[model samples]
Target: MTQSSSEEEEDKVEEDKVEEEKGEVEEEAEEKEHEEVEEEAEEKEDEEVDEAEEEEDEAEEEEDVVEEEAEEEDEEVDEAEEEEDKAEEEEDKAEEEDDRE
Candidate 1:
C-alpha cells in the first residue's frame, strides 16, 4: 500500500507539471497573436495615411487648375471691355468729322 501511494503521488506531480507547461504554451501563443494583430493594425493605419495624402495632393492640383482657368477668363473679359471702349471712341470721332465737313 505504501508503494502504491508513492506512485500515485508521482503521477499527480507530473500531471501538475504538464498543466503548467500547457498554460505557458497558451500564454506564448496569445502573445504572438497579439503582436501579429498590432502589426497588421499599424500597416493598415499607414496605408490610410498614404491614401489621405494622395487625395490631398490631388485636391490641391485641382484647385490650382481651377484658379488658372479663372485667371484666363478674367483676362478675356478685360480684353473684351477694352475693345468695346475703342469702338465707341471711333464712332464719336466719325460723328465729329461729319459735322465739321
Candidate 2:
C-alpha cells in the first residue's frame, strides 16, 4: 500500500512539470507574435516615408522644367530685338549715303 501511494505522488510531480513546460512554450509563442507585429508596422511606416520623398522629388523636377522653358522664351525675345536694331542701323546708313550723293 505504501509503495502505491509513493508512485501516485511521483506521477503527480511529472504531470506538474509537463504543464509548466507547456506554459513556457505558450509564452514564447506570444512574445514572438508581438515582435512580428511591431516589425511589420515599422516596415509600413518606412514605405510611406519613401513614397512621400518620391512625390517631393517629382514636384521639384517639374518646377525645374518650367523654369528652363521660361529662360528659353526670354532668349528668343532678346534675339528678335537684336535683329530689329540691326535693320534700323542699316537703313540709316543707306539714307546717309544717298544724301551725300
Which predicted model would earn the best lDDT?
1
Please give the lDDT score at residue 55 for candidate 2: 99
Ten-residue region with minimum lDDT total, candidate 1: 83-92
Give the whole-model CA lDDT for all candidates, comma-separated. Answer: 0.99, 0.96
For candidate 1, the lDDT comes to: 0.99
Q: After best superposition, candidate 1 residue 27: deviation in angstroms?
A: 1.0
Clash counts for the predictions, in order: 0, 0
Over 15-98, each residue of candidate 2 has an lDDT whose tens digit, in order, gives: 999999999999999999999999999999999999999999999999999999999999999999999999999999999999
Give the least accurate 10-residue stretch of model 2, judged by summed lDDT.
Answer: 1-10
Error of 2 at 31 (Å): 1.1
Specify the highest-TM-score model's number.
1
